[model samples]
Target: MRNKKTPKIFLASFFLFSFLPLMVFADSQAESRKFFIDSSYDVANREQILATNKKVSSKAYFYVENDWFNKLEDEDKITVEQTLNSLAQEFDEVIYPRLTEAFGPEWRPGIDNDYRITVLFHQMKEGYQGYFNNGNEYLKIQNPISNEREMVYLNTDALFSKNINSYLAHEFVHLITFNQKERLRGVIEEVWLNEARADYAPTLLGYDDEFQDSNLQQRAKTFLSHQNDSLTEWLGEEKDYGVVNIFTHYLVDHYGLRILADSLKSSKVGIPSINESLKKAGFSEDFSQIFDNWLIAVYLEDCSLNEKYCYKSPNLKKLKISPSLIFLPSTLKTQFSLNYSTTFWAGNWYRIVGQEGKLEVKFEGVPDVQFKVIYVLCQNHQECSVDLMPLDNSQKGNLSLDDFGKEWTSLTLIPSLQGKVSGFDGRENYFPFSITASITRENQEQEIIAQLRAEIAQLKA
Candidate 1:
C-alpha cells in the first residue's frame, strides 16, 4: 500500500535493464574507487567505515582506502584512523573466519591476487550497494535517509537501525550472486534480477530469522490492504519486499540454489520473464493461471516472478452433469433429515465444471445440523496446497464426502490471517465456492451423494 503520509514523488514505473557490455571494460575505464566526503557523510559515516573495516580485515590481503588519510584535520583524522585500525583488528579476529566459512575457500583472501574487491562506506538511500566488475567492486551504504522524519528511513541516523544487519547481509548475497554471474545472465536483466535476488539473501543466510519471520506476516497484510489501479501502480512497491526474501528462501530450501543462480544469469524477457521464471522453476501453467491463484491467496496480485509457488498443474478432467447427478435439484433443499444419508464421506474428491469456471472438493459435512448443504471447494491448482499442508484452509474445491472433521482440522493450522481480514490463514484468495447437492432416504439410511459434475445447463441456459 502506498504511504499516504509520504509525499508522492514522480516514481518511475518502468523497469530498467542493466546492459552488461559484450566486452568487459578495461580496468582503466571502470568506475574509480574514489570517496567524496561531505557534511552528509558526517561522524556517523566515519564510524560505520571503521565498523565495517573491523568486520572484514582478518584475511589482511585487502587494505582500507587510505588515500585521504592526511586530508582531514589532525584531530579528526586521528580519531578516524584509530577507529579504522580497531575495526581492522576486529575483522581479522572475529568476522573473517565466519565469512570464509560461509562463502568457502573461493572467497578466501589472497587466493586470487588477480581480483581484489573492496567495500566502500558512503551515504546511499539507506541500503547497501555491491556492484562487481571483472576485478572487484565496492559497497555503498546509508542507514536510511528521508527528506522527512520517519522511523525506518534509510539514512545517516539509521546506523543503529534494527535491520542494519539485514541490509548488509542482503548485499553479501550480491557477492554470492557475483560468483554466480554465469548462471544469472540468461534469466533476468542483470541489475533488477540481482537486486531482487539480494533482497531475499538475508533470509536465506538466516541473518535475522525472527525478524524475517515477523515480516512475512506483515507481507500478507500489505498485499491485501490496497487496490492499485493498474499493475503498473504496484511496480517497485516495497512494503513487503521482505516477503520476497521469505519466498526466495523457500525456493532455495526446496529447489536448491542452482535454480536461483540460473534465474539471475538468465536473459531478460521484460514482463514475460514472470512466466519464464516459473517455467524455469518447472511450472507449466500460464501466467494468468498462477496469478489468479495468487490474487486469491494474498488479496493482491503479485506481478513478480518470486511470488510464484513453482508447482506443476495437476491432471485436469471435465465431466458434464448428467441427469442422474442433478436429477432432483429440489431434493437437496431440506436440512439434514432422514433423507440425508452419508453416501459420500469426507475425503471423496470431486470436481464441478462449468462454462469458464471450475471447482474441486472433498466432501465436508455440514457442521451445523440446521444447515442444508456443505462442500469443500478447491478452485484451482494454486489453492491445491495439500502438499504444503494436508488440510489447507485457503484451498477451495468441490463438494466431497471426505471433508468432515479432518478437513476442518486443517483449517486450524498455524499462521492465521491477521490485520484486515480474518480466517484467511494463508496467502491465498477467499471466494465462496458453490456446488450442487442431492439426497435420497431409504430404510432409515439417508443415502446422500454429491457428484463431481460440470454445469451442462450453461450450454442450455
Candidate 2:
C-alpha cells in the first residue's frame, strides 16, 4: 500500500488568491498605472526619440524613442507594423464586440469621433515587454481613457525579440479592462481579477500557456508530491499567473466565456463581481462552488469516468500524479475536509491495515456537498488484491463502505470529489467539508446484534 504511485491532485493545495503573471514593476507596480498623477519622473531623459513613424491611414502611432529602434532595418519595421495592424483588427473584429456584449452598449473601445488610442512603440527599461496605463486617468470621473485616448508604452526591444503575439494579447486585455470597467461601473477592476484576466487573454486567443509549459501539471505535482502543501500555502504568492490562467479558462469552459462581460459590468467590485457574473451567466454556482469542481477536475479530468463532473482538459488524461500516502497512527481513523482554494483534481491514498472480515469505512462530507466519494482501490503489490470502487453518491452525509471485496488484505481509501461542487442556490464557492472516517469489523456488528436479541428475549419472558 505504501508503494510509490504517480498522481497530481490539484485540489490539495489551493493557494491561488493572488492569481498572477505580473512583474514587481520597473518602478513601483502600484504606481505604474497611475500615470496621470505621476509626471515627476523624466521618461524623456531615459531615451531620446529618434523618429516618429506614421502610416497616415492607420490610427496607431509608433514613436521610436530608443536607439535600438533606429538600428532596426526597414524590413523589420514592416513586420512590426503588420503585427500591430493584426492586433488592431483583433480588437475591432472580435474583442470589442464580445466585450461589449458582456458589459453592455456603453462599454466599448475609445470615446471620441476618432476612436483612436496610442501605442508608443518606444524603448522601456529592460525586463518589461509592454505596459498600458490610464493615460486617460485625468478624465477618471467620466470613464477611464475614452476622452483622452489610451497609450501603451511599448518595450520594442523586448517585444521585437519575444513572442510578440502573446505579449500584445496580455497588455491589450489590460487596456480593454480599464476602458470597459471605468466607463460602465465608474471604478477600476480589482487588481487580482484585473491582472488574472489580463494573463487569461493569451489563453482566450487559443494560446494555451499553462498547458504548453506544463505549468499546470508541474504546479499540481508540487501539491500532490508534498503532503503538507495546501491551497493556503500560495494564497498571495506572485508566481501564480499560471494558476489564475487555468482557473479563468475553467470558468469559460463550464459556463461559456460570457462570464468576463458579466464580471465587468457588475457594481460589486472584486469577488462579489465574480459572483454576480456567474449569476448572470446562468450559473447557479459562484466562484467558490466552481472552485470545488475545479479542484476535483484538475486530477479526475477523465470524461470517461464522469463527464458531467469533469473538465475538458484532454491533456489531463495523460498526466497522472503519484498520490501522497496519508499516515494514520492509531486505529487508522482521520477527520479531513475539502476547503482548499484550488480547483485541481487530487486525492489522498490511505493504507488500511490489520483488517479482514467485512471492514466498514464511513465518510461524512460538508452539508450540501456535491462531489464527495471514497475510493477503495489498491494497485501496488501482487500478493494484496483489494481493487474496489468508490462507496457513496455525489451528495453529502455519511456513506457506508461495506462492499469492499472479500479476501483483500490491503485496501486503499481514496477520498475524491465525485460530483460537480455547486450550491443549492448556485452562488457559493467556498464550502466547508469534512469526513470523519472510522473503521469497524464484523465482530463488533455481531456483538451489537446479539445484545439486541437478548434484550428482546427478556422482554418476551
Candidate 3:
C-alpha cells in the first residue's frame, strides 16, 4: 500500500481542536464550584475569610469581608452599603409588615436580637442563588461575575436589588420561623412546609421575582401531570423545594400567610400542621382534599372557575397528558398500562371514561415502591377535581363514583413517584411498569337509596 503521510498542519490542528473542548470543560467546571448552595465558608467555618477581614456592619447587617468591600471603588462601595441597608429595610418594612398583617402583633418578634444576616460575596456558579443557614444566621450571596468587571468591581447590576431582597426576605422567614420569639416548637419544621413558607415569603414581602414565577409554572406543568409523585422527597435539590412553594402559596392565597407562620409556631408537623393552619384559616377542606383539588386545578388552569389556585406564570401553560386509560365496562377488571415510564420529578397522567354506572377504579401488579395516584372526575378536560392515594409496598386505593354521572366522560389518573426516591440516583433510565386499573359496579345501595327516597316522595305527593 502506498504510504499517505498526513500534513504536519493537519496533525497540529487536530490535536489543538481535540483538547479545546477539554480545556473549556475544565474552565467551566472550575467556575461551577464557586456557586455551590450555601458555599462552604459560612459562619460555622468562616474563620478563613474572617482571619484577615474585619466584620464590618453596613446600615442593615454585619459582613465579614471588609477587605472585599475596601477593594470596591467608592461608587460601588456605596451601592453595596445601600443595598445591604435596603435588605434590612425590606425585612423590617416589607417582611415584617406582611407577617404582622397576616398573623397578629403577638406573633411578631418584640425586638431585633443579636443575630443579623451576613452577606458573603463570592463567585457563585451560573445558577447559584444565595443560600441561608437559619442555624448560622447568615444570608450568603455571590458576587456577580461579568467580563465587564472583576467580581470585586461588579456594578449596580451585580447588586440585583430585587434578587437580593427576595433572597433576604425568603431566608429571613426561615430564620424567624426557627427562632420565633414565642418559640412554638423547638424542632425544625417539615422540609416541604419549611421551604413552602420560604417560597411564599418573597412574594408576600413584595420582592417576588421571575425565578419563582417561572419555576412554579414549570413544576406545575411538570408535576401536575404526575400528581402522584412524592411531595416529601426534596433532598439536595432546588425544584422539589419549589413544589412545596405551590402548596404554601395556595395556603396564603386562600388562608393568608399567617397560617404558614403559625405552622412554624405549632407543634404539629408536616401535613397535620398545615391542616391545623387551614382550619384556622377557616378552610373547610383538610390538607388531603385540598391537595386533591390542587392537583385538578394545576391541570386545568382556569382562574374563572376558582380552579385558578396556583401562582401560574403569565402564559398559563397547559399540563401535558400521558398514558390515557381504555374505557371498559364496570363488570370486569381491565388493565391499562403506561406507554412510557417517567423518571424522578416526572410522571404519567391517565384518563378512563365511564357511563353513569357506579365506577370503581383500582391499581394492581404495581411494584412495591413509593408513588402517588391522583383520581379526578374529569368529565370535561377543562373542569377537573382531583383525589390522591399512595400505593406503597403493594398497596392500592379503590374509588367508587356514581355521583359524578355520565357528564364525566372520563376520569384522570396520574401515577407518579411520590418522590420517595431511594436506592438509585434520580437519573435512572425509566422503564415501563405493569400497573393495572379496573372498573366494577358499585353496590346497589346508592341506587336503592335514591329509588327509596324517590318512592317515598312520590307516595306523599
Tens digit of per-residue lDDT, candidate 2, span 262-320: 67666666567778878776678876666555554554454554453455555444443
Please provide TM-scores, in order, for all candidate models, with all chains considered together: 0.37, 0.54, 0.57
Model 1 RMSD, rounded to 1 decimal:
16.9
Error of 2 at 300 (Å): 1.2
What does candidate 3's lDDT look like per residue over 1-461, in tens digits?
Answer: 00011122221222221121121111111121122223342323332342111223322232324445557789987776677566556656666557545533322211122222334454334443444433222111211211110011111233654466655445445545544422334344555555666666556655444645443454455444445444554443544654566555655665666677666667776667767877887778876555555555555555655644443534333443354566665433433543446544343556677544555666643464555677666656666565566555765566666654465767777655533322332234443444454443456467667878998999999
User: How many clashes would you count in candidate 1?
Assistant: 50
Candidate 2: which stretches are off by over 4 Å? 1-51, 54-59, 73-82, 85-114, 122-128, 139-148, 161-163, 207-238, 313-461
How close to the true structure is residue 331 of candidate 3, measured as C-alpha lDDT? 35
Identify the candidate with maximal TM-score.
3
RMSD of each: 16.9, 13.9, 17.3
The lDDT leader among the candidates is 3
- Model 1 Cα lDDT, one tens digit per residue, 258-342: 5555554445432344446667878666444432333222321222323443322110001111111212222333222111122
Winner of 1 and 3 under TM-score:
3
Would you list the clashing residue pairs of candidate 3?
A: 35-124, 35-125, 228-372, 229-417, 229-418, 230-417, 230-418, 230-419
Worst 10 residues of 2 by lDDT: 1-10
If the candidates were sorted by their lDDT against the true structure, best first, what order would they fall in?
3, 2, 1
Q: Order of candidates by TM-score, top first?
A: 3, 2, 1
